[model samples]
Target: MRSSVKALREQGVWSVEFTEAQYDLLVRSMVTFLAIEKERFARVVTVGPRAEELDAIISGAERVHGGKAVIRTSLDDIHMIHSMLVFLPTLFTSEEDFVTRVGFFKENVAEVAAGLKRAIVRTAVDV
Candidate 1:
């Protein structure tokens, strides 16, 4: 799935078809994954920086899960979410790795979750 998305991105194709139901499932799955990551992170690093960033990512995912935020039904968004999910596990190999890679992790989450709140307003106006 990751390679397929990368290929699509390389081809400059940003559109993908996903029913609203599928989008809902995707968001829920993402939230679940992040929640699991939180647990792993806590175990790996009892106290550390970037913890708040993880919390913020979870909050963003929760907002989207609860329909308080809207996700643009774009393939790029799907790719990003998938990429984050895939990348998160790599951080758990060691504490040092997690610390070093967390900034990148948070960046990806923020980028993927960015503007989700604004999407809700735009969608409502369109409707």
Candidate 2:
């Protein structure tokens, strides 16, 4: 996924398939990636359980900003992650813009990453 993000910066599109379990991790990774690379991924699309939570965060942010975040979601765990990378490059130019775009979502990004990481690890162990 990090590679995809890097490549996306050079090119404009990237899409990768992930299992439903990997999709869960992808959501967390994307959130963390967005937070750290906020300048690069200002606009984003997230999917999975975490994505639903992000939708609420974005909705609240939209209310406060008086403008909508350029984010979209499918609520499907795997598809969201796949589509997100494909959609990411179209949203921002640099990581700074990505961070700025995170806005209020920053508060929840850490918590979500931690939870998703645990879930991903546990799932991996079980499988």
Candidate 3:
């Protein structure tokens, strides 16, 4: 799963025919991943071409406390996610790529959840 997703990321700058459920999974995992990475490295992450947008996303994710709603993204959120992190599907050519991407997330959600938990733990300790 991760291999296919990584392959799609390798190509870059593309789209795929993703169903709503697939989009939800990808969006959820991507956002959660971004949120944790942002939290785990907030200071350095403050700088980048897409910093502001990514910051805004992480902020929202934090506000929701990185809940399921983070994955229930709008078109704008989808576009934003496309521009940041590992990026999205490889092409708009088929649903297969989309399914592969989403499957990658589904397969890795527990990992993302653990990372997110650690991130939250760090913040709580500091607070």
Scored by lDDT, the top model is: 1
Residue 22 accuracy (lDDT) in model 1: 36
Ranked by TM-score, top first = 1, 3, 2
Clashes of 2: 14
Query: How close is every model to the real structure, measured as TM-score?
Result: 0.28, 0.25, 0.27
lDDT of 2: 0.37
What lDDT does the true structure give each of the candidates?
A: 0.39, 0.37, 0.38
Give the Cα-based TM-score of candidate 3 against the true structure: 0.27
Model 2: per-residue Cα lDDT over 1-127, one tens digit each? 1111111111322212233333344444456445543432333323433543543433322111322122222224324444444444445576565446543233233343344334444544554
Model 1 TM: 0.28
Q: Which stretches of candidate 3 lie over 4 Å from their true place?
A: 1-13, 39-48, 51-127
What is the alpha-carbon lDDT of model 3 when measured against the actual structure?
A: 0.38
- Residue ranges of candidate 2 with Cα displaced over 4 Å: 1-90, 104-118, 121-127
Q: What would the per-residue lDDT of candidate 3 be over residues 1-127, giving only the tens digit for each residue?
A: 1112110111222222233333355455455445444554442333334444544553343123223223333334434454433333322245554445455533343333333334334534554
